[model samples]
Target: MCQWLASNPNELHLVNRMDEVGSSKSVNFDGARKMALKQIEEFLLSFSDPHIFSEAATSSAPATLAQVVEAVRIPEAGNLICSAAAIGKYVSMLQNPSSLLRACAAFAFVQFTLPGGQHAMHHAGLLQNAGASPVLRASAEAATARIESKMYARIVLRNLEHLQSSPSTQF
Candidate 1:
């Protein structure tokens, strides 16, 4: 059911929305958005910091990342996540020693700026400004990267390319 919803463009926005609604407090949408994005950004950045956790204790990191990936599939989340700081953090993950972390960052980019996603252009602009494309291109072209990671990087690059040529996308 979750997979089906995420695959469907009509339902994609609700993956994050449903989670938010269930956990939502009595706060305005803007405030709630800020809080949620802040938490998500912190969680993602933590992965890039080796000092934050001992490797032996992060066994469930993949499972936790899967949930985070699902949680930010909405356009609103994309808008919030395109901030320079957030994008830079993600880029650092892209450059992490762990190939798994790099793959996860690429996957997050795919979800965050899905081609038809309302904020894709803005996210693309920020990503480009943060110099993510070179990193992504390297990831995609690297023979050493796992096939899955390479493909996710390719997908994100493609989405950004598509958005760049899009007449509606303004700098």
Candidate 2:
């Protein structure tokens, strides 16, 4: 009985209190975890330029990473992107600490929901269900986020708002 009371949620809060812990240091998760996002970025780049995405892309080469900010705007690239990663997954990645990861995620979303994409409506529905609007807004306002990432997020948000307001003819 005493053990149950001691291990309650309220007790856990006391253990994590800022005063007791000295500081509430925030954690950034861009170590080995970054590899997963990097792999995804490389895969995204492949759709637009497969011949160039050779072994060099697989390396930690900084130059290739620089080009990741702009989304692959090719209409045909959309469905292919969806085949590799889901819209909901990228929507959730908006909160990651790595700015580049957030940027890539945002760009991927922009491509997924671009007006001419094959799965725009379906991806939009997935994004809607994942609550992407609020997430994208928050990403745009995040001070730690890169300007490119913020801009892409805003673009996606505007698209979503337009989708909600307009007729079913287009997204």
Candidate 3:
């Protein structure tokens, strides 16, 4: 299943449906779930470009990446932090001409800022930059609020303020 998923990342929706059905008490899909998660991690790490999350080349990629973010276990958080941070860089995609692409990029940033989102602090700085679009700014605001970490929130707020005061800044 993992090999198949790795070869066909776009088919993650099927696995998602399987997981939902397997969640019942009568089912024992623990092993399969674990294997799928491990495969997700491996697939992410092996992919040459972490920008896939931002690119949203396929209609399902954003949701699939969201599942990947949710599947990240605590023990391996450190190992995947860099990848999360890389994905966060795509927050700039919020400024894209296409609204659908912008929305997808915003969704990716929101996932990166969720609980257990390693390296979110690093991503906050990018969100605060002048290049960030209004969509990115709003998403960053939501992220900082959702994180509920005073220190991180403070940093993001400060950056937001800086960006707001600099009218000459370009997106």
Candidate 1 per-residue lDDT, tens place, 1-171, comes to 224223322222322454457568763455654564454445444434332223312333544433333443444444333566666666776776556556656766776677667667878988988989999999978777744456557667877888999888886
| Candidate 2 vs candidate 3, TM-score winner | 2
Write the residue-wise lDDT of candidate 3 on 34-146 in tens digits.
67656544543443233533333232343544433434323333223323333433543344333333333443344334433444454444555434445544643443222
Arranged by TM-score with the best first, the candidates are 2, 1, 3
List, residue by residue over 83-108, the lDDT tens digit for candidate 2: 22345456555765557657767776
Candidate 2 lDDT (Cα, whole model)?
0.55
lDDT of each: 0.59, 0.55, 0.40
Candidate number that wins on lDDT, 1 or 2: 1
Root-mean-square deviation (CA) per prediction: 13.5, 13.4, 15.6
How high is each candidate's TM-score? 0.54, 0.56, 0.31
Which number leads on TM-score?
2
* Stretches > 4 Å off in candidate 3: 1-79, 82-89, 130-133, 137-171
Q: Which ten residues in a row are the worst by lDDT in model 1?
A: 4-13
